[model samples]
Target: MTVIVRDLRPDVPADTEGFARVRRLALPYILFTSDSVRHNAVHVPAEARYRPLVAEEDGEVIGTAQVHLAHDSAEPGQGLVNIYVRPDRTGRGAGGLLLRAAEEHLTAEGATRLFTWVLDEPAHRAFAERHGYRSSRSSHFLRLDLAGAALPALPETPAGVELRTAADFADDPRPLFELDTETMRDEPGDIDVEYTDYDAWIEQYWKHPLLDRDLTVAACVDGRPVAFSVAYTDGGGRYSTAMTGTARAHRGRGLAKLAKTHSLHRARAAGLTEAFTGNDAGNDPMIAINKWLGYEICATEVRHVRELG
Candidate 1:
């Protein structure tokens, strides 16, 4: 069978479904949906030059790659590509073809360096290394069984604090954006990103298809959000915490943990069964909080960087 790598056609429903299906199968711990796939394809900023490539074999999409520049990062010429092939179709040359296309595209777009996240497995690491990528930081994919897991009770709000939902900010979400921007400064990552575009943030985050407004909990200090746990549900039984962070000023007050706890309780009550979240391996605080909430390490992946000659 001949495998051909080509750009994913977002207007085609089957292409989106196939991409999501392969991603779900290759990385079960993380959540993927057809809507998310389409959203990224359509809403990606022009500066990022984001492209989703699919490897088609025998009329089936067996592999996928998301290639893009780090547009939001202060540093330029930093590109990234994540490739995933169906578990059963690994040896059919699909991955290599997808990687080649992604690399060519990114290099043409002026990428001096590229990065990718590869699953922490023998074959996966081997593939990355063979492609000249060197290992860097690692992260863990965590899972919590919301159906049966016993989560911590939400602590009483401080005298000046209150618990609210992201839905409460329907009139305006600038506060949440400011809080997220501040919290992200402390988030462990290889890239340094500053979220300065409110319109871009709204399109990419606040209006995302998977964001569950009702289940997303926020800790407010006198009507200003200080901490929050952004929840995403796939309209099935799967719920994921997209982000849980506390503003620097609110650190050590356990507001993040409290917000996440409330979000989890509400998610389970709404019939979501599985909860998923990922953390940088070095983020002890978030890992500890997740562990406190009964989450376990389900899988791990390592970031790999390669210099383009």
Candidate 2:
């Protein structure tokens, strides 16, 4: 059977469902829902030039690719293409077709560097290398059993610090935005992101369909969010931590841990059975915190880069 690659139709229920299905089967460590897939395709920032692609075998989608420019990065011409193919569908050329299509699209968008993530398996790494991509850094996908594992008890709120949920900021999320912007700058990655657009953040993150505001715990000092654990629920008893960090001024205060611990407990109480999170391989502190919170390294992915002149 001949496989074809094409842009994803966010408005089409089958397209979105198939895309989400491919992602879930290939990378179950992360969360993906058809609604979230549609939301991302519809609400991506204009500068991102985002294009979601699907590899179709006859009518069934066996692979997917999320291609876009790093619009938030201070450096220009950085593009990202994350591709995933169903395990049972690999070696059928769907992955290659999707990667080539994504590369061609990003190249047309003036991307000088292309970045992608490949599973640590030999076949995945070899496939990337054969396409001129080189390994840069690795990250671990962690999982915690909220329903079975013992979660750390939420500690007492330190004096002058209050624990709150993202829902409390419904009237105004600018404070959380500011905190997120500040904390994200220090996140370890090849791309340096600067979030100067508040409205974009609200549209892309704060208002995300998967974002569980009621379970997103934050540590506030002086009524301002200083540290936070962003929570995303799949509505299927599964939860994921999208981000967890402390503002620069708030680091070393254990506020990040406090916020995450509280968030995990809240997720468990809310009937979330499985929890997932990712950390850069070199991020010792966050790794330690996840381990302490009962997370186990379930999978790893290596960042691969291909530079185009």
Candidate 3:
């Protein structure tokens, strides 16, 4: 069976469904949907040069890759290609074919370095090593049984800080955008990101179909958002924390913890029975915060980097 790589046809419902299916099977910890797949294909920034590729074997999508340049990074020519093959389809050449296609695309677009996330399994690591990629930092995917786990009680906010929902900013979400950008700058990752495009953020993040504005909790100081925990519901009783962070100036105030806890409580109250979140291994503070909230490590993935030169 010949495995051929090609760009995903967003207009084809079957293609999108297959792509999302492959991702779900390979990385079930994260949230993914057909709508989100198409949205990313259309809404990503032009500078990103994003390309969603799929490996087809006799018309079956067995592997997928999300390839794009790190446009928001301070450094230039930093690209990323996350490839995942269905667990049942491994041992075939689909993964290698997908990687080669993604690397060629990024290289043609002037990417000097390529980064990918590989599940922390021996087989996955061996595949990456065979391709000249070395392991870097690792991240943990944590899961909490909202139905059974006892969540910490919500803490009282200080006099100057107040808790608010993302819905409160329906009239204007610029403050939340600014706060997100500031916090993301300090996030631990292989590539640094800057969220400067408000319209793009709205199209790609705020307006996403899964984003639960009503459940997303934000900590406000004097009417300005300083920290927030963005929530996304899969409409299947599963809730995921898309992002949880505090602005640099607001760090050490426990505002991130406050926002996250509030969001979790709201999610549970709304009947979300399972909650999932991810944290970089080096982010001790966030890990501690999640642990305090009763989250346990469900899975781990390592970041792998390869130089094109």
TM per candidate comes to: 0.99, 0.99, 0.97
Once superposed on the true structure, which residue ranges of model 3 sit more than 4 Å away at CA? none
**After superposing candidate 1, which stretches have Cα over 4 Å from the reference?**
none
Best by lDDT: 2
lDDT by candidate, in order shown: 0.93, 0.94, 0.92
Query: In candidate 1, what are the lDDT values of residues 1-309, reduced to their tens digit?
Result: 899999999999999999999999999877789999999998888899999999999989999999999999999999999999999998999999999999999999999999999999999999999999999999999999999988887677778889999999999999999999998887899999889899999999898999999999999998999999999999879999999999888889999999999999999888889999999999999999999999999999999999999
Candidate 3 lDDT by residue in tens digits, 198-254: 998998888888899999999999999999999998888989999999988878999
For all candidates, the clash counts are 0, 0, 0
- Please, what are the lDDT tens digits per residue for candidate 2 over residues 272-306? 89999999999999999999999999999999999
Off by over 4 Å in 2: none
- Model 2 scores a TM of 0.99
Decide which is better by lDDT, 1 or 3: 1
**Model 1: colliding residue pairs:** none
The TM-score that candidate 1 achieves is 0.99
The better-scoring model by lDDT among 1 and 2 is 2
